[model samples]
Target: MKIAGRTFVVSGGASGLGQACVEEICRNGGNAAVFDLNEEKGAAVIAKLPSGAGKFFVCDVVETDSIAAAVKQTMEWVQETGKPLGGVIPAAGVGNPTTILDRNGDAFSMDTFDFVVNINLRGTIDLVRQCLVHLAKTEPVGADQERGVVIMVASVAAFDGQKGQISYAASKGAVASMTLPMTRDLARYGIRCVTIAPGIFESGMTAVMPEKLFKGLAAVMEFPRRAGQPQEFAQLVRQVIENGMLNGTVIRLDGGLRMPSKI
Candidate 1:
């Protein structure tokens, strides 16, 4: 399906990779509804877009009510703009570095694991399912009878869990695992699902990492020897939306980076 004249719902669109996707969509003549908790950042992102090209809704992906409300508002905005709901991209996630046991041999906190999974895995699924309720109702756009697409964000850690990344990896790994089955389940509705497994990139999550650790991670990249830029990730997101056959798969956007057990 074409992006122009259609609206896409993007969670975490106020910053990092999500923000870049919003910018790319608007630049290509599509509208983006940015769902994020940070009003200041969300407003900033919307301000940079062309008038009527973007809208910001304060949403917490972990809350069912918040997602329901955002989806409702997004459909209302779509009606006002005369733009059909084209797709959903759940890019909001979090990573916590916690081992199964602490140095003193204490068991890991179940609370911490639950928190990470709730945001990264459950939140992703909740957003997609909520948006699908509206997206599946839209008229099919092309000869292929396509309604919309879903692009979820995973991480290289899903494949290669490093030290102290148990919760993070488990959450991301679940997301990767859901791609194919979810796509199959949505096929009857003319909706497609895909996942992007990104390597170490410049994001809010990584920006706080110590310099030594960041550089160590970047060093593993085979080519260019650096972290990915948010724009590069956004470009892939656009291509996946335009390419009809990119369904039920996980495409890694890392620069030939096969992460080792230790970063």
Candidate 2:
């Protein structure tokens, strides 16, 4: 589970939490296959990494063929770099604030609900499965015969779904709920599964929130009353990868923030 000399597949690696993870991995002497749709941002991220430490692949996680193609390209890059696939991080997600009934009392848009679910829930699972296809076949690396790890990103909203977060909460909750079962399914292959449920992190999803709402979220923090740095999230990701005992569970990266029902 060592980060050094290994390659990790990271979705949404072009920015925010995923970008921090990519930087952290490169700093620790590992390689990252960054799967993202933004070519410019992807290239910028790769440019900052150590030479040969990162590569970007254009991938839209909602598309099955896109993920397959990215995985193929990643393996080929892995071969070139001589780094074994060590982990997978499916961090690409989106959020939409929509109530069951609109301001005019109209029913919720099914299209909006579907779009959120498809990206946040289905997209994450698909990326992990696609990467696991190859990760399972890799040679086991340590005394535990561990092949790789999966670090999924969830949100505190999964547990504390305030008003207008039905779709977002459902998608993230499913991710947290699937951790144990997915781990069990992959255990024999020496692949571990764990999910991270973060609260009020400085991610793309939070950046667009109104100033008042953002401040309200900060007020809920028990200490260091502020948004979490992306690096802090990245630190936990590294810990999960190196610690063999962290499997089959969802770890909260929140700073003691359970999130109020109104926030």
Candidate 3:
């Protein structure tokens, strides 16, 4: 609902859409803490904002220990200010393409496949569980406002999982699949769960693609014919928070373009 005075934890807040969301939150007078591996960028982001209980913590979200530590630090801060840790954004994720035809297809280097699933799926679940624990300590708002809100970032690959996207698809698809069940499980406590499934956007993935390739991809966006902006996605996040009724939804932020199987 009202962004001001709320406290939020944004994972992967060092850059990209997570960074934009953090900025938007601070701009709206809400306090925030970033949990990410990029300590340099995370610290810089915190410094640039108008400081008011906002800070950063280094975390390899794939590890339960790290997630628990993050929640510990965040709860400590919230307790200092007597504000509830209102919600979380598990926007930390990685993507790579590997064809099923490759000899390594089934042999997905435990290094890569495990890393992806651990960070994308397990990290998300870890945060949700921790949030529930902390939310239980807070009081729910009488009306539409929730005790907490969880917004996860899933890729369009989860939907159009291309031929070479075995691991990536499975990982993100898990996020897509869990949105509703999570909402239902958390409803009695006044907690809301939502997912953001972005299409080809100007994320780190597109940043590495060649200009020609990027342009070719952009030309195919279902409506805008261009990659959506981080701010656009953040705006939708704000909308989700305000429209309390919009829960258990995995919004496709890709301007109508279904991924052609990211491989």
> What's model 2's lDDT at 63?
98
lDDT for each residue of candidate 1 in 162-208, tens digit (9 for 90 to 100): 88899999999999999999999999998989999999889888998
Candidate 2, residues 1-263, lDDT tens digits: the string is 99998999999999999999999999999999999989999999999999989999999999999999999999999988889999899999888888999889899989989998999999999999989989998999889999999999999988998888999999999999989999999999999999999988887778899888888989989988999999999999999999998899998888888788785
For candidate 1, the clash count comes to 0
2 or 3, which is superior by lDDT? 2
Question: What stretches of model 2 exceed 4 Å from their correct place?
Answer: none
Residues 9-43, candidate 3: write the lDDT tens digits.
Answer: 89888888888889888888788889899999999
Selected candidate, larger lDDT, 1 vs 3: 1
Model 2 worst lDDT window (10 residues): 254-263
TM-score of each: 0.98, 0.98, 0.93
Candidate 2, residue 85: Cα displacement in angstroms equals 0.6
- For all predictions, the C-alpha RMSD in Å is 0.8, 0.8, 2.0
TM-score of 3: 0.93
Alpha-carbon error at 118 in model 2, in Å? 0.4
